[model samples]
Target: MYQLPFTTVVESATSNTKKLELVVHPSVSSKFKRYLDIVGSLVGLLVLAILFIPIAIAIKIDSPGPIFFTQQRYGLQGRPFRIRKFRSMVTDAERLKSLVSNEANGLIFKNKNDFRVTKIGRFLRSTSLDELPQFWNVLVGEMSLVGTRPPTADEVMHYNQRHWQRLNVKPGLTGEWQVNGRSRVKDFEQIVDLDLQYQKKWYPLYDILLIAKTFYVIFGRIGAC
Candidate 1:
């Protein structure tokens, strides 16, 4: 494996070392990181701007509510950030969530034919068009073009210390789990494992590969919703 500029020691003389570990600065990959986020997001947002009009019209005709759905999710270092997505469910879906959450995988809540999903919601989710607003997050430096998926507050609370390493880099709009098997894979630990793989082996080339794979997955419409 390659080493970063600084060597991270587990502890100094005053404290006992639990396990020695190396920590890399997020800035190590800063240049390409910013480039991809800015350029890619800008292009993506432009495309979505063109596409959003039609989607918004469809959503409005299918349901009654605002055009967007904003929810709080944890970003790098467990920081709180609001993730924006097009509204895919009824306005009252959150209120009705608890009652219908019983069928969830215990870690992630998923229902293919969920009652909360509007006619347009199902298609948006299947096509992943609902996630287009996250490009705004990428443009603003809140997220990355490729990295670990951001976790919700509830998901973060359940995370263990080791799992926190996912926050070493900016969260992504698409990630290993999304491409690998999102709804099909329900093991939260396995998701963290994939995140750790990305963190430990991250490189500009790896990111490019993941991005290409993501595009394939998106257009292929595999493992979606």
Candidate 2:
């Protein structure tokens, strides 16, 4: 059993809305969760180390840029943190975002056939191998093994008060959104709804279930890419 942290209310000057931020303090279960994150992340990082060379070589052969993609993402309580992933797009992909047509609904961007994705990148994205580096984030406490997907600063800038609830807990490498429908889910509001639902019903067992489902989703390719 665990307790939902107290809520802290803050006024948003830009939107003139009150945002409820959950202030989670370390509890026994929370500490256990963190312990699991550390152990799991260590194992994950070992796997990443084994595959890093091959993936890096593939990226370099496919594109002329850094092998790792780093971006600022909102974490717990809307704090900014740098998130890392294997680069799966052309070097100029970010610059080209404005010119490309978005397939996703709401503030987030998604395009199944995005031209910016390199051949190797497409494969990596489909296999979710590009996200392997995020274990480091989990190991360092910037993320959890299971929680809401982190949002980009640009995406968070467009979020409504209710949408902000998702950031109450640490972001994750895989969560309800990843296991549910992923890119197939066109509506961003649905993703937020899932996040809020996860928050409301969070338990150690729930996290375990999500992690188990994630493996099936990935290996089965239910909604990959």
Candidate 3:
């Protein structure tokens, strides 16, 4: 296991003022995990390279917009990083969000039948192919192969101090929430609870198990879209 000295920055549980506390460094078990992230991302990128042309062509033909979507997401310790995804919605999707009613739980927005989604986008979401570009984030150390899901800037803004604990670790391409029933999970608190559970019990073998379960979820087509 590999460990890094870290400082925990949090607002006082009782006070409005922010505070910093240095906790004893925990064994990270991340050296091999980082190695796996590098190797996995490389292989993923190679597959992306092979699929890019066809996917790009499909996206362009289905809608008039960029092939990729980039958004700012909170990473480890609430650091901001750009996350990339294959575009699956209208070019004006974010702006149009205000016009539609949200069907998701907590601070997130989700609509299985969202009109903003293009025909190809539906398939992309169902297959999770839209997330393929995140392998680049993994390669760059902005993300992990398995960990907590990254929150959007808007999502983070709504979070309380307890919610910030999830940011202690690098966000992931897939995680407990995803495998446990991602699209099906309605409450944001449940998601937070699962992330906290992962943090408390983190180990290399645990990550491997989650990764295996993620494959089953993906191929089984459960809780997708």
Models, CA RMSD each: 5.2, 2.7, 4.0
Please name the candidate that would achieve the greatest TM-score relative to the true structure.
Answer: 2
Tens digit of per-residue lDDT, candidate 1, span 66-144: 9999999877666678988999999999899876744445456777668999989999988889989999999988899
Q: In candidate 1, which residue ranges exceed 4 Å CA deviation?
A: 2-28, 102-106
- Candidate achieving higher lDDT, 1 or 2: 2
Lowest lDDT block of 10, candidate 3? 20-29
What lDDT tens digits, residue by residue, belong to model 2 across residues 146-171? 98889886787777667776877889
Candidate 2 similarity to native, TM-score: 0.90
Question: Which model scores highest in lDDT?
Answer: 2
- Give lDDT: candidate 2, residue 129: 93
lDDT of 3: 0.82
lDDT for 2 in candidate 3 is 30
Local distance difference test scores for all models: 0.77, 0.83, 0.82
Candidate 1 contains a number of clashing pairs equal to 0
Model 1 TM-score is: 0.86
Compare candidates 1 and 3 on TM-score and give the better one.
Answer: 3
